[model samples]
Target: MSLGKKLKQLRKEYKYSQAVVARDIEVSQQAYSFYENDKKKPTMPVIARLARLYQIPMSELLNAEENTKEQQMEKFIEVLTRRIWAIIDLKYLNNNFFDLCLVIEEQARISLMSVQSREILEKKEFDLDYTTLGKLRGDYLEPFKEEIENKNQDTELIPNLVETIFLKEKEIASKYFE
Candidate 1:
């Protein structure tokens, strides 16, 4: 997929509005919308913050498929049905990502659209949805658990999946660690 498409998919997977992503990356919602629609590419700093905010590696955020060898790296990629089953099972049983979001929400970066940004989008007549963001938090996470756990039909190693989800979640909650 193109980087823009990949970015859009990631934002949806995480259930964020353009304003939310922009705020997290410290950019205007218009700029973020441009990035998603491929009107422009984001700068390296913006890309880094985006990768960090979305809990994904820079390569995966950029969809660096050309780096196939790097993508196939053993540590970053693993079979879905293998030893990492432990991690899968943990995610399946415990959907704590939203709670993690709640706990660190103030300190951590966020991407929800403010009223002003919503007005701007409306004025611009863009079709992006900024509503229901607060509601989508825990609700959107459950349906994904089983699908993610079972996504191993081809058995290829998926690269940096954890960077976008698992490890990033852990990193967000690190202050609670003992």
Candidate 2:
């Protein structure tokens, strides 16, 4: 297409008036309108200025493709990423324990879905010795520790509480090895 069509397309994409583009390019609105309507040709300098103002490569504007496969691929990726984040946001909104429990769980769940635990631990070289991982484990798996500690119970209940805590700790530990 002609320079006028390219300039008009760029102007419309940005919701810019012909007058604004003309003012910025140091041309009269009548001249810019003539250019857009293909009745007049813009000087080389005016074309350069228009290209700069539109923040698009002159080549892309002159040879604009409405839906190239590469552009379609990029748009698809952008939309898919937005949708994935929306789903994650919804999960956090629905779950009250979103703070630390959520993000870690989501990551772990994704990993498990894509690979076996052995592959994750061995092939991916996931670090099992991290201190923060330990803290996260304690936070998620041992939810009743504070309650057990703060309980106003008789001396008779101490052994039962201790046994429950021990069993839960053992269960959590076994998960790591598996």
Candidate 3:
């Protein structure tokens, strides 16, 4: 029972159309639709108005289970974003460009995989074991590392290497997003 579901249930019980409810709440019908779909959260004032309209407490309008799930998701995203930025923002690395780039690349791949939409993932037909980041890691990283090992780690090439990795990541991400 999400807030959306509760709102919808109340509307049905009262036999009111969305336009009627929107007029009562002083909002547009589109905004009311967004609330019922859980795409946007109503403000505290809007919630209080809804409570008064439905003759229910404001607390009853909020679904505790949905709030908990949303909180957990917010925390997870914060942790993931923090980890990636921490690696990318490293200022002092003991003159170790190779290790630093590798770390950043790995974290970038993890972020890419972890942040995919669950709805999109469910609709796609693909092997769960295969990921785009894993393929990119093999295609770009393995050969780069091997070349570095053979050529004795040229420091001047590190910048070009980092740029290539970033460009490849952007290209792959753009395709998916588009």
What TM-score, to 2 decimals, does candidate 3 have?
0.37
Model 2, residue pairs in steric clash: none
> In model 2, where do residues sit more than 4 Å from their true spots?
61-178
Task: In model 2, state the lDDT of residue 7.
Answer: 66
Q: How would you encode candidate 3's per-residue C-alpha lDDT over 42-124 as one tens digit per residue?
A: 99999989999988778767653354434434433443456544653453133344665556556554544443433444555
TM-score of 2: 0.37
Residue 134, candidate 1: alpha-carbon lDDT: 26
lDDT of 2 by residue, 22-42 (tens): 999999999999988889877
What does candidate 1's lDDT look like per residue over 1-178, in tens digits? 3566657756864679988989999999999999887899989999999999978789776663243433322212232113234443454324444543343232122221210123434554323222223233334344443444453422124344434443443332232221
Q: Please tell me which predicted candidate would have the highest lDDT against the true structure.
A: 3
Among all windows of ten consecutive residues in candidate 1, which has the lowest summed lDDT? 107-116
In model 3, the clashing pairs are none
State model 1's lDDT: 0.49
For every candidate in turn, the CA RMSD to the true structure comes to: 15.4, 19.3, 14.4
